[model samples]
Target chain A: MGNSKLYKGSLNTIILKLLDEEGKMYGYEITQKVKELSKGELNITEGALYPALHKLEAEGLLDVEVAKVDNRLRKYYKLTKQGEKETVNRLAELEDFIRSMQQLVNPDWSIQ
Target chain B: MAISKEEVIYIDNYLKFLGVKYMDIRLEILDHLASEFENIQEPTSLGDFLRTKRSFVKRYENQWQKAKHWAHQRALIKRIIGYFYKPNQLFIPICIGIFFGFNATLLPKSLIAISFCISLIVPQCIHFYIYYKPEGIYKNIQSAKYILSIMALPSIFMYLMGIMAPIIKESPTVFYAYWFFAMVFNIAGLQEVMTLKRQIVKTYSKLISN
Candidate 1:
């Protein structure tokens, strides 16, 4: 698992970015994707993921649809129009943060 | 292993403790988990299934907590809004009485006295409403503020009018009436102010304690 403290801040962005790419995903699938993308570096527990998803859904940022997948009804969440817009904004914010961090770490280095 | 009913009840109580009030939502979650467990056709240990279910419940509980918090906040706001109006029902009659009382010269003295009687009844009615009707702390606090505002309006109007125009000629009777009205106004205003202060202190203390 990635640093719990660092993961706390970035989890929402990570979820949004994933939904932006994948279109729609179930709870379990989201957990798997995060692990795969991070090469198992970041392991999101069910405890954290569900609450974030529900909160985002409540805030009108995400829309949910439940359907039977392999005879079991699975709740899938997709980014709403608002969610998509939020994703772009969050991504830009994260990118800017990363750039600033890089500058701080290597003050002598300059981007080409 | 088949999931027992007791396990389901345990889960239900846990969710309730976490503030999940909707029965249908809780049942839906339980059904989903039960189905997942049923799908494991091969004999699996109850302990393993319980472990897996625990993880699932934990994930969903996080979402429930956020949603519940939002709901609780919305409820508090609604209760406060309700309080603003609960006391206004009393203030209206008092206002009408004061208006007609001041204009008694244009009407019968009996009518003015009747209006005063109605005004007195209104405050008692308000007291009954405040006591009998159960309200949340936020709502009670808000009602107190509303009552204060209502009390201030008449005094403010009378004070301004008295300063601008000496409606009643300077006499001992008129002076006594003026002092009496001023006392009533002050008492009503102070009652509301004190109530509001009490509510504010209680609310702040609750927030701090939490």
Candidate 2:
């Protein structure tokens, strides 16, 4: 349930960051990647993933290529030029968020 | 146990309730879920399979609602921004064009050339601005049509004041050419406005169906 809220806010950034790291990925592959990375903590269901992909494509942030994979047509998404720039910006923001969370959790932690 | 065709129909209807209008995508997703049920070779009963499928469908429906809400909010923000930007985009250029074009006769040759250049540049700018911008195509075009109607007032004033009479008598062909061009621009603007209205209606209908 907590993961769902995080997924809602960070869906675009996560998709963008993944595409930035991997050249292109299919919908199922994306879900699997998120699950694997989060060690089963965050699961991206099909319902949540596809619409976000579509929205990002519409916004000119992502480009899609449909291809036949193992007798199934899969839509693969990759970062557009704008998406790449957006990924960098989103990553910095996420990093800042993580830093802030760390400060809040460990109030006496010293700066490295 | 095998799944019944009625279950597929039920799932489809549920998706329809969730506002998924793309038949192809909906069918594909349904098929995927059905196949996942079919893959279970063990002695699982139909009821258990359906229970699992129902949970999956519920999860999907919730997610779909969230995504739709997000897209709607974003589109709304874009529309608001486009509304404010539309006037500046349309009016500024047209005003510059009229300012320069009206004073062309009084100005020197170089100034006349500059005025004509401004006149040409302004229309082209309006064209590109309306054509390229992702938002407010319909609104901008309607506003342009209104502006064109206002523009006709000047020509009417010229006729009433006999300002165009000397030109009409001195060079009838040149006067006809100017009149023809004005009519064409007015028609073009009106046509653009009509087309945009059609597009807006089509887009809204699609949004509703989806």
Candidate 3:
């Protein structure tokens, strides 16, 4: 498992990227998806996932729909039009960040 | 491994006991907890699962409460500003501004006081109604109350500043500014109330119907 602190900065971008790919996802599904994708290396705590979701929703970058799934109400979040646009921008920014980190940590690692 | 409705309610009660009292947050937490329980490969009692997950639940509830405080403030401001830019939503605020402008000179003190009272009281009434309503989705939603209080703030401020009445009477500029702000805020508040009601109704309509 990677250090969680190392993943913290990219969490929102990661979520946006996931939603961009998945269309819509609920809270539990999102955490599980992240864990599965990272092979359990990056566990998104419910504490972190939900606040990020709520912040994005507040920013109008995400939209939510509530549905009765099984015996409970589930809030499913998806990218809004703005969110979709933001995902592209955020992904690009994260890519730039990764390249910068790679250059700083591994001088021999050349992407070009 | 699907959780039963009874188990869902039990989880909700446990969350409440853990200080996650807001219905909306509690509902979301309950769903997450239920999902975790559903994923368990081995048969486990609800009590055991809750005991194991108590720390996580407490952590989330605390973080959510903090995040919600800021999110509520930001969303309220965003919605209020967003309301004016939408063409369809422009009508009510325009009418309010026009009405106040037309009546500015002729409007008596009693009428102004009454207007302020209405603006102050209406949002509160809506909040109280929803908060106390049986099975109302917003009954325990803290954001609803937070938004309503924000909506009422302008009225409360203007009312308290009735001390400005003497100054307002002497300066038409001040009076105009006062009425303009009052008109804008009251109209925005009304719009927020409508939006909040629409959201609650739309989000929970299925549950209501069931």
Full candidate order by TM-score, most accurate first: 3, 1, 2
Model 3 misplaced regions, further than 4 Å? B4-6, B19-22, B59-97, B107-137, B152-156, B159-170, B208-210
lDDT of 3 by residue, A1-112 (tens): 5578998999999999999999999889999999999898899988788889877886778998878888888878999999999999999998998888889999699465
Residue A91 CA displacement from its true place in model 3, Å: 0.9
Candidate 2 lDDT score relative to the true structure: 0.57
Q: Write down the lDDT of every candidate, Cα atoms only.
A: 0.59, 0.57, 0.75
Which residue pairs clash within candidate 1?
A46-B59, A51-B63
Q: What DockQ, on C-alphas, does every prediction get?
A: 0.12, 0.07, 0.67
Best model number under TM-score: 3
What tier of docking accuracy does candidate 1 attain?
Answer: incorrect
Runs in model 1 with CA error above 4 Å? A108-112, B1-47, B52-210
lDDT of 2 by residue, A18-74 (tens): 999999987767877898898888888766777788678657688756454332334
Over 4 Å off, model 2 = A1-3, A109-112, B1-24, B27-210
Q: 1 or 3: which has the higher TM-score?
A: 3
* lDDT (Cα, tens digit) per residue for candidate 2, span B102-196: 66547775665454445434544454455455764333222223323323322343343256557745774664445434433433443443554
Give the alpha carbon lDDT tens digit for every residue of B68-144 in model 1.
45533343334334443767545533664466557565757566545544544455345335534575343422223
In model 2, the clashing pairs are none
